[model samples]
Target chain A: MFGLEKKDARLLILVAVLVAFAPFILNPFPEGSGLAQFNAGYPDLMQRFVIFGIFAIGFNILFGLTGYLSFGHAAFLGVGSYAAMWMMKLLTMNVIPGIVVSVIVAGVFSLAVGWISLRRSGIYFSILTLAFAQMSYSLAYSVLTPLTGGETGLQPKITDPRILDAALAPGATPKANLFGLEMGSSVELGMGSWLFTFNAGYYVAAIVMLVAFYMSIRIFRSPFGMMLRAVKSNQQRLNYTGLNTKPYTLAAFVISGMYAGLAGGLMVAMDTQVGAERMFWTASGEVVLMTILGGVGTLIGPVLGAGAIKYMENILSKINSDILHTWFAFLPDGLEDFVVTLIYPFIGKGWHLTLGLIFMAVVIFLPGGLVEGGQKIAKLFKRKSPVDDSPDGKTTPAE
Target chain B: MGILEVKNVGKRFGGLQALGDVNLSIAENSVHAIIGPNGAGKSTLLNCLVGKLIPDTGSVMFDGQSVLGRKPYEINQMGISRVFQTPEIFGDLSVMENMMIPCFAKRDGSFKPNVFINMLKDREIVERAEHMLEEMNMSDKRHMHAASMSRGDKRRLEIGMCLSQEPRLLLLDEPTAGMARADTNNTIDLLKQIKEERNITIAIIEHDMHVVFSLAERITVLAQGTPLVEDTPDNIKGHPKVREAYLGETQEAA
Candidate 1:
């Protein structure tokens, strides 16, 4: 319902096409590709892109649409993951049960958190949500260890049940199935030089992600989304106009929580693991970063952001001093060592520094993020020839 | 009997008495104007009527039903809509989308979960909003963002949004609060047009004497949280009590 702009609908279709064949487009330089580690084509990483995309999309419903900054939404994601893991452990080894459980748990959790936190507005509301998330995190780590599995996390063990699938034993060790379909199944294509492996779990995650993305589009175009925006722009006016914005805000919050839950469920389905770390405040902060980095209100922006951040996390961490030395082996011995040493800090743990700088630059220069930047750059080239002769034309603003 | 009635409405915010013994009645399809100085409890009285504040000791009846503790949306559903002092159009939404909201509310009287369906397919709503915008002479700017419009145009859009709901009573809190002379006159003309075209009762709180004198049939003067005088617009301009309470020395010499 997100009043889909004509441009946005076309963008969505383009994104869908890109995601459909990412494996080949992303891995063009297959032989000794330096970007292979950063490739979003791998099933594990692809699952992550979709899952976090769902997470950021949900976060946008509240923070983007309603202008309510929630610092505690990660708790819902973490809770969803834990709930999914529990479903895998106690109910069935199928991802369906995990997904259902995750959604319900997240919905209930958001209802409680939103009810209390929404009582306050602005920073106070943010702080309240933060406090609730921290409480959930603490409880998951220690107080609720029996149910949450504590610091060790709720990993799938040999004793887990698999009710639906007759082939998977009652004591199977972490088997993740979708319905009755095995997630481990994969198809290998092409000769030895060009191998493409298609994993079932990755496709499952992709399908779910697409559904969630479509749902968000609907919400944005709905009358409800309009009301939420009105609440954000002028809450007092809505109150006077005879509309109680509380229920609307709460609905947005709940919808966002469910999205986080779906992401959490898919995460466990891909890896069959859920940890207390998922609910950490930094994880919540990361989703906010994804939405902001991509373009908070833009539907596809968050998905692009999630992929970028995750790629950095995975690939950037692998570029150590040894890898650098391997790349610059032909250089002089001293020069190679110097170059490797210089690049060492920024490659691994220091990658976060680069990300932080990028975030800062975006917030300062491109407050509307990538969307505004792209529009400006497009306008710059589009009008350069005609506007070069006119002073007034150059002064004209895009906004 | 009055279509809407307020009896002995009183409210105190800690040390300040915002309203004290405020009483009024509104007949169906009549324009009622509430005028006062800055701290005259005019807005506080409106807040009480719309259920924004619970009056300490009084009751507000809308269409013969008590609206004292009802929620704002409930009040709206029961046929009352309000326009704020500063225009409160949905800043990001286009002009037409803003108008469609109240129309949806009026048609459904309940929220429908039709996120994917093309909302513009509702011909009735589209026609009604188009006609209302045409009346305001804002039909050309239908697709423009509400935030991009001028201050006067934004007010017109806000009034149109409220009117689209087809409320039985429209409460306006200083609809011409911050407009230039020409813009204020334009707003006055727009309001006069709406009154003539729609069968809706209107209660406006105004600081502008020009706006009040142009449209108000009856005027109630509020001073220090109490009604100084309630009379016809002609009588209100000449009332000695009103001049001392509000117009002060400037109008007295006239």
Candidate 2:
């Protein structure tokens, strides 16, 4: 209905419903229950789920379509965060300007990086991008200290002269806001023993994520997207067909970079803080993991992947030996101790081991990622249902 | 005067002289064949014409414009389309998608960020692609992946992709290379049809005498990095120098 085909429109609506009801869906367990530790309905984690989803969606435009694996996307994200912080510190506490500036700044930065890095493709292209990201990280950590606030990063301060915003009270601290509504403010609903918390910032970010997703779907179905796929498929044929591969690849890179920047700006809008660690190589790698884990080219895969990883990162790491021991306390002393010890490495501080094993399994068994798995399951159900075939065992006629 | 003119074009790589003092002109709306033995510089000459290589001491001109410094895509934009030895269609895309790409390139030029417009809704591109597929007799396989098609069908699709652009000149590099006899015959028939129907110049590099004699109105015999003879098919077959350089051994074997 939104200028999308029926299939794509359905998918978009499904995602919108899921995101809108995430607070209730994520917090399934009642308050003070034993399983409450697994609840992921917190506003902070929900924001991250959508933010990283945007990052991976953008990355997919480059890696999935154009087949350019950029290892330096985090540099754009970091630059975006720093730009948003400076805007907040100087202009006002309002997030609209900060977010807008963040995208533009990141676009310019990525344009320069893409122009240089796109010269060499394949492994050389990957290494060039990696080198650029590392250089940016180093500059932010050391040489560009005055601008980036060095390794310490930047934040809004009461003493700073905010040209567009009024002075803060003597005893009050600055908070990032949209108009008069603070990002951290939330509404709580208590029904019997179950409790649901909904935050203003989470809804704001969710709306942005929905728009980003809709735009990505349009791009995937557009003529430009087909060209990007051509660039990936047979660049030589494309060149001989009178199409320039350089500009197409460069445009994809810059568009993806701008997506990463928007994600970075959103992070500051939600938290009112910026850090150089946001641009770390591992952060860049995490987006790649999310994309591959969900499904590289599918529209909804990145968001699912981001949610899966963030859920595991938050909930799995919270499980300790004590929690494990309590679950097995009914067993004898020695048996409980042994079980706790055996499971300890896979949880808490060693949760990465579990994540790594899951990643390996996804790459091996589900090469097309979780989306393929879901499709297989859907096919199984469709096969079981032969009601559509006919009442007398004859198949339906072809249209 | 011909549409394409190669004047004293010479190219060398290290100690090996790939092409030397080559001069040729391909007339408009004619099927021209370049026949040669292995390492005879036919491919090298073709590469020089398509902007893949710059000549050491000559000019390759198409329609009175020098094509030396231009990129391959720019050269293509100037009304030249090339088909590779192996069918070079986008293997991962569907047959319809492969045809639409060139149509888009023709309509939108080298690069256009029509990122928001729906491809299916773009009536011009869709109609052109569908018409070309129908013209190529592949409308039934429109949704099938291009890579899964047979070798003959792949070659047909590639030729259709080239024709969809309606370039002034079409270059075919060993169009029937590594094909079964039936597929080769099918390709020759397709090329013959293309030549008859379109007012386009066709330059083909081939090892098969059957294909050359069937399609080429004028023949150029190249041997050891130079043109040994350029004449009509009947005259080329009777030329003593052409027989010595290439045709004699093949005629004896046949």
Candidate 3:
């Protein structure tokens, strides 16, 4: 069946339950515990995890299915953010309008870019998209200062009116309120000394992420997705067989762009700010990294990559030399010092180097990333392994 | 009346002339086979016809309408469908999914954007696809991933994809070029069935003489980017110029 299977439906429900309980799971430390350096319970970073998960998932739709590597996806995110901010400034702070505007604007932008880029295939298409994104980034930084607010970015100001809620002052900050339901408010559950807090905002973002996830699953199952895969495998054959694969590829590109825009809009809703830096090529590269790290074509892979990278960025960076020294105090004083210093380069700003090394290692050895590794391990546990390197029983050409 | 007319089509790549002053007229509902030695511009002519390459000077007409400067998909929408030399089925998708795509394209003029609605419930599209697969004897492999199938099966699935569209004109490029003896025989039988059942004009470029004789009503021999002879398949086999142009040294014996 082209629709979700029973197992898939069950898996989705399990994932939803886990996401709903993320705040409680992450906020496990005692209130004033001195060892509470790794707190992933915060709303800001949780929103980031889900939003970028959406971005990487969208990117995988284009690159994974079509084999068209785009290096300019950040431009879509930036455009979406700007569109969302404009919605906040003009209309209500309600996220519905903001998300709608973001998706529409991003889709239009992707259509224009896809039309020109599709004129050429392979590396030329990649370079063209990169050039377009760079052009957009520069325009946002300088020429379009009024709309983008230049390097300062567009932010909520004290004087901005809150038309939806008159009780709030004109200068007051806008919260993500859905029909008078406060987004920032949390539900606290206590059992003796133990406590758990779940923010309404995180749940909202989680729900949106789930919807995005479901939509992606549907797209992957549709006939349209099949055409995109055909285009990737053999364009000449597709053409000769009477299929015009261009429109199909363009459709995929637009759908992905809309997803990226939705992610950007959610980001702005969570943070109340949109920055020009979001459009940088490095941001674009990060999404690619996430997709590849988890597994490019796999369904749940990008989410894992997003969570892993974001967790490392937030938690691992906080581990200073002092904390390391305390953990290894049982060993000799000088040996502990040597060990901490030895691992110091890989923990903070050096984290990216570790990621790069890991990426290269994965590319060289496990080209299919974590998904393939997991499959291989599963095969090892089972006595009978498949005949070929392909995880599924197919003779597909390697990328 | 010329259902498809190519007038004064000339294509050049820098200094090399791929096609020069080439003209062709396709009668409606006729199976036309274009045969040639290697590098006789057979592929270039097909490319020009399908809007893949723009000729330096030429106009291509389909159903008395200009086909030049139109996008390939737009041309497909105008009742033209193509099948490549190699099988081009979606590797990840099942055989049924591949068939359903062209059925969608045929039923709906453009793509349907209501992605939220489940596609499996669309019984009409499914039934059409099933019928096409049955026509190709591929209904048994409907749930199998296309990439996992044998070469013969893959070709069958691809043919089913094109047939689902129900195009007025079908283009095939070297459809039987790489098949084994058994597969070739199977393909010959498949082509015979397709021509008999579909009632559509098929324009094919084939290196296989067996395939050409199997389905093609008329045959055109090309040499050095020009049509040397166009006649019935039986006449083409006996024609002196076609033998001389295609067989080379064997022309004296003929």
Which candidate number maximizes lDDT?
A: 2
Alpha-carbon deviation at A340 in model 3, angstroms: 2.2
TM-score leader:
2
Q: Write the per-residue lDDT of candidate 1 for residues A1-399, one digit (tens) a residue.
A: 244556547766777777777766655555456645555566777677778988998998888778898998899999888988888887878898889899999999999999999999899998999899989999989989998889988887775554544545555556788776778777766545555667788788878877788777777766677676667767765665556678888888999989988888888888887788888889988998988887777666778778878878877876777778878999999999998888887788889987888888988897767666775798887876642422110121212
Candidate 1 predicts chain B with a TM-score of 0.95
Tens digit per residue, CA lDDT, model 3, A291-347: 888777766777877887887788877777777788788889889889988988987
Predicted complexes: DockQ each: 0.31, 0.49, 0.27
Question: lDDT by residue for model 3 over B130-153, one digit each (tens)?
Answer: 888888888777777678899888
lDDT of 2 by residue, B1-254 (tens): 89999999999999999898899999999999999888999999999999898889899899999999899999999999999999998876778889999999999999999988989899999999999999999998887777779999999999999999999999999999999999999999999899889899999999989899999999999998999999999999999998888898887764
Candidate 3 chain A lowest-lDDT run of ten: A389-398
User: Is 1 or 3 the stronger prediction by lDDT?
Assistant: 1
**Is 2 or 3 the stronger prediction by DockQ?**
2
Q: Cα lDDT for residue A187, model 3?
A: 77
Error of 2 at B23 (Å): 0.6
Candidates' lDDT values, in order? 0.80, 0.89, 0.79
Best-matching candidate per DockQ:
2
Candidate 2 residues lying further than 4 Å off, grouped into runs, are A384-399, B252-254
Sort every candidate by DockQ, greatest first.
2, 1, 3
